[model samples]
Target: MGRIALAELSKYLLDGHLSRRGCLGARRVVTRPVAAGWMLPRAGPVRAFHAAPGSTTTATASQGPAVPLRKQLKDKAKQAKKQGKKKSKADSQTVDGWELTVGIEIHAQLNTSRKLFSSATTSFNEEPNSHVALFDVAMPGSQPLLQQETLLPAIRAALSLNCDIQRVSRFDRKHYFWWDQPSGYQITQYYEPFAKNGHITLYARDGISPEDGESVTVGIKQVQLEQDTAKTLVQTGNTHWLDFNRVGVPLIEIITDPDIHHPRTAAVFVRKMQLLLNTVDTCVSGMETGGLRADVNVSVRKTDDPVRKLGTRTEIKNLSTIKAVEDAIIAERGRQIRELETGGVIVGETRGWTLGSKETRRLRGKEGEVDYRYMPDPDIAPLVIGDDLVKHLQNSLAVLPDAELDRLISEFGLTPKDALSLITLDNGARVQYFYRVLDSIHEQVQAEFAASTPPDLKSYSTLVGNWIIHELGRVTTYKAGPLASGELSFTADGECAQVSGSDLSQLLYHLYRKHITGKVAKELLLAAYLDELEGGVLEAIETNDLWFKEISPEEYSVLADKAMAGEEKVLQEFADYIKFPQGKLMYLVGKMMRLGPTERIDPAAAENVMRARVEGIRAP
Candidate 1:
């Protein structure tokens, strides 16, 4: 496939499905799936800012256009702003001002390797029905045997959320008839839940919150253990194809109090919840992978009403992404507001979010507690949470986000936003990798730089954090398929093998000391991450010739002018800075970055020189 074609494929592959024809018209693709190094072609050497058609100029060659930096890593700042605007317009919808009260129920698949009620393997990649146990298939004689492996992560998750664990909690059956669920009902904590009374502080996020960083505390109603239904992989008019691999998968349903008042804030709250659950190793938190899903309860009330009676709340079901969560609320809010104003009553119903149409369509009237017909499970005994186990899990829990944020900001001198961004990167893997690199820099700087302490140690930390967030961030997270974790290598065993903390420290140390330009440092990161730098960055730079060549300001000016001479559109955009943003100049910069055989010139420095040259030309 072509580079641009493959890049488009890269985008599709991230969504858990790839529908393209086989590579090179061979009608066969390499198994293991094509992934990693999304920006450059799979086999070619990359130039700095390898501009593709339809990509905006000033953005990274991989991802087109620059999005505003967001403190909450999951939520994109620009997207949130635009979505918030839509929400404001939709919610501005009443004769009297209204308030949106939202409560979210999230079902996250547990991290256990096996199913909750049986020893059937829980891997989603397996063949349909291959991993199913007799119990999962609801064989007449088969009985449910609770997996003990399921409880540890659940306990850890509850404790991490600061919930009070119920010593004796029993499971009840939530009766429902569905093709995917082999059993007539799901075993869940209904009459008595295992954890309750916890609260999560949605830290004042820039784009997602009301006030700048003023924290809102949302009460945790309960955290209950449950079994997930099987997946409906394909559906025809009268037939449904099911994947039983997900059958009996362990899940935790976290019910939050109706404290969220805004759509964006609700999304932020869910984002925070995903982090907490993943932090305690409760579940694989990616919604795309069937790791988690959310159902939101939305009700609108008049702001001026002294009694403040909430309208009939409609449930929006099966929201798969954080963005969808926010959007569903916004859509439903608009629907309800429009209906109420038009003299139609707000009826309680279960609605499904349609992604294509971007609207909430009614599935059925809401199923009440009586409708579920909850009954205590006869097979599974009461869930007894021993104090000893709870205490042990409390002690063993990994540092939660709030405490970590405090440490990173106070001790490390990192800005709160930067610290949160660092920790939240790629499910906190980047933070671990970042800490290792930062700590290594602390020790290695003295020997490498020949100074006890650098003049501006704080700048070094900030620089390191930025690289991890920006460049390394782009390499690891730009693509959607097969997430690149802490280490940036394809080595077998896949630990911190090819590009460890020491390697990054060494590369950043060189870049920090002005031994190499930013372009050189980035190229080295790509090389090291892709395992092209076999003997580590130091050895490669020492033994191998430096791939990047530094050019002077005047040379950069000449290249910038050469790039701009023939491109009238870009030049015109440059001439009119107000009309064109950081967009058109990207092509000019990309041309300059690719001036040499390899990506050698520093983009930051080159861009500055190019801008100066553009100014000089326009200055009449």
Candidate 2:
């Protein structure tokens, strides 16, 4: 088959099955039947269909404009219609007989205070070996003591995935050798996961349908509670040192069935799962920090039969990011397709994701489940979670992104996309802070706007979300640990050192009442948080004049007009600034107000006046 034709088929398959379906926050339902008599293609160097053996696989010069897979599908569809009309031409030009099936296995790190079977802290960013406990280091005579904090969060996460949490669950040992894994065998929950049979909602440009999102309940083989390994730093001298801090951190291994059908779909599912996990404070999808990883299992076939016609599956391990995960799947798919097209076969093996080249390279070996030597831990008693306990957890379940999105839609009139964007956070605390700020703004703004119009949280939510994602993300990376030497800090026991909630609230209010845009407020917030966190401030942050100062109303308006006049093109660029005058003008007004007291401008009043002008811009 021509490469164009194969690309076209891939699209038809993706769109046909994933475009129109029905589902909303449900578990994966297995409905497709597996086909029999599938054959694995032989593996070898990939070559183009028309190329002779030993010919180079590199792209030739003078190819036309690159066509998108979707467009290729349309062209093929048109060609098919024309060919159907000419029986004589169809025999030579028509292409047929090919199928591809995909399945994905994702490993999501669980959020917890300590490791699964040890007291080693699971917190991110500490001294190299500080968090390591005796059991984590595999020290002699050390026995495992499972932490409820870890187990409970794992259970919640499984539930969040829409998986059926098994009523009875147990652990097993997974044997693997790597620098980070101090234990020869990782004790993991395998036989019974906390949950299974769940699904997540996904979105695509064409708008994924129920069937598209109705992902097959990729039978979760299990969701095991496990221990994470430590980090290894390789130096120039070929020397490696271990940072055992993360060695015993709690981890949940979620193993999925071979039910996924495409790479992008898998990416979407992983993202959805990440959002849910982060929302419930169950896990942090820390790609850079190795808190989240994926081992993708990919296979291909030439038959449309759901279960039949699969080439060998290759496992791509420890893909740290969503992009890497997606790219690996696509690359693997392309490889499989090309191999089969040239009468080559895919060999089952393990592969490593290479970000630099966006490809997967063969790993040494494949370790099947049988290699793990599943056995119950004799030291630790079986984990027994009571119904009442689960009920209590459900009752006290943290606000999830889904519920927050619903609130944004119903209460603030935010679009689903906007709501989802607002809730984006690597840590649950940040998301909670976002909602808190929104609630604060809503309480004040709603009462003021309620008599005339309904409240819209879009402005406040967007402002805060932007600040958190950008500014906070930057400041959090600073080396000095939030504040200076010491202002206030939280003890591992959960007690505050010097900072109090009232003081923090006052500092925030001072900044807010200054008429500061969220960006400016965020700068002040980071400074204040650091000061307070490091025991440097009690009343000092509140007394900072910069936090209370604002530009006067008239001065702000004059500056806004000047900015507008200086850039007429901006008027066209941000036409919405005039259309939604009140909401949009504030962003620009805030920019102008940033001149601070030198301009003696009150940004809040400047916003009102500038909004009045912009609102008039659209008037007859």
Candidate 3:
């Protein structure tokens, strides 16, 4: 009976004369595909497709008119079948399955001080109701006002996504029920969003080359400006609490097409978006507590023509971690596949993934929102952005994260991995301190070898990348923790804002000259960074006795002699090791100096003397 109704609905939509406005409107009716078998009740002249029960097949494209309606119906079926195949293919890449279509709606909280429609404070973690204004809470007689700061970021993100920013955009009501929502409807862009028809480049992990990495493109549908709803806190005793702190906060919703195929790629897309937003300072640095959240819609279908076995789409909600997102996508794909293979159909529903269990449970129906009944919010007027305003914003909008990542690679000579890591850690502030420190390091090294300039970037880029990602990472994380011992301190907001690049450059130089091997150089750098995190008086490791204490010069020489005296089998590699280039020799020195057995002397000095002995042998 359900299949018959769906086939009739598909026939009606195809046969009906839908006006352009009706076709384009947000309220267009959506009907699921009819499964094989079960004919519809004859009403008027509409014809429907039907097959015998247990046939496992239905009508094909060759038998029908290629009208938009027919194509949509046929496409839905094809999509469903492809979805079923997606599972086996995932487990074994060679398996044939449906292609997965993923659409992302990224909700980025704006970096602003006031709410969109009210004068309430937009600060995070304030007393729940303190930031709420009567107007924000939708109290009687309060009116909505506009906030320019909120709109600009949306426009910027739209531009970044290559979207067409509409000059006049208005808000509408999205009705829903939740304790956190003081108003029954959320004011959001629907009829016409702030931006439209944009795309972003997403690099799937597979797309990256082992030799040189690059990303592929993903299409974006639009970027819209919306007001955020209040948050609900699930209390301990099966009760829920409301917090209006987030009410009226400006938000930008970026919607993308189902171009993504893999969960990791989706995560990469999110990360890239976060980087772009943060670097431009358009949105709150995402992934921070209460900064941003995302909901993902994923569907799968087979590749056969007029495909009739389109797998169901599942909405995965509130996935905060990238890893979790990938896992959920994989798990959901598996769940759907297993059901289909067992002769059970996959249902289209909204689901939530619990990271702990790695399983997704159905939460609600997707078709329920077919009647969201959105209407214009007449209280607020449309935003009219002028050409002058757009120009100013286009110019003032900070450099994008992609360009920054590329620049970090070219200027600093970083590997794709290293550049990506630093950009990820630094966010939009990638330039403010990190690059400055790197540049200072380059300059100081050049000055140290004023008579002989430092080697070109290729030699040092990896070192710099490793130093920042590993050494500095430890410092940043530790300073935010309790054991941080340096002068600088992590602010309550958990940022190391006061630290400087020149400070890092000087500290590293000091480490290099103190006869600290590359191994020890990282240690000393981290130690000084610890001081920076504490927000106290700036001090170096030498001042604090944090440098690795060294053996006397005479003691080191005796140890070197002992190492060469016996164990010819073990000692054989050392002779050739000393003969290798400086780069290879440095690696040996690093191994010797690390807290490993074999040598008690400092590796750097031992390296210098070993080279001399090797040269003596070659001279003979």
Whole-model Cα lDDT per candidate?
0.75, 0.60, 0.65
Residue-level lDDT of model 2, residues 1-620, one tens digit each, is 21334544464344222211223113232222111111111122211334455444433223333344465567778888888778434321112454435555656677666677776667666767777778888889999887877767887876666666566677667787776777688777776656666655555421232335533344555566777777888888899988887776777777766766655567766666666766676776566566677788887776656567567888888888877866787777777777888988788788887886755788766777876677776776767777776777677777766677778667665566655665654244444555555565556666656788853456455554554445445544563364444333343222233323333344444444454444445555566546543533334444553444554556666777775665565455355443353434666676666644543565457766776666666635
All candidates in order of lDDT, best leading: 1, 3, 2
What TM-score does prediction 2 earn?
0.58
**lDDT tens readout by residue for model 3, 1-620:** 12334554564566532222332333423322343322222212222224333343333434333345566577779988898788544552212555555677888888888888887778777777778889878889999988777777777777778877788888888888777678888888887888888887755332321222356677888777788888888889899877888888998888888777766677677777777777667787576565777888877666565557545777888878766666777777767767767888777788988867757898887744446778999898888888887788888877776787678778777766767776665453443555565576777678878897566765555555666566666665653467554333333222454344555666655555553445545555554554443432134444554454667766555544554454455444544554445654454445445523432355657788655644443322
| Candidate 1 local lDDT, 17-116, one digit each (tens) | 3444455334433322122233222221222223444443222234333222222233556668989899666543322477788999989888998899
Q: TM-scores of the models, in the given order?
A: 0.70, 0.58, 0.69
lDDT of 2: 0.60
Candidate 1, position 278, lDDT: 78
Better of 2 and 3 by TM-score: 3
- Candidate 1 lDDT for residue 17: 30
Superposition error at 330 for model 1 (Å): 0.7
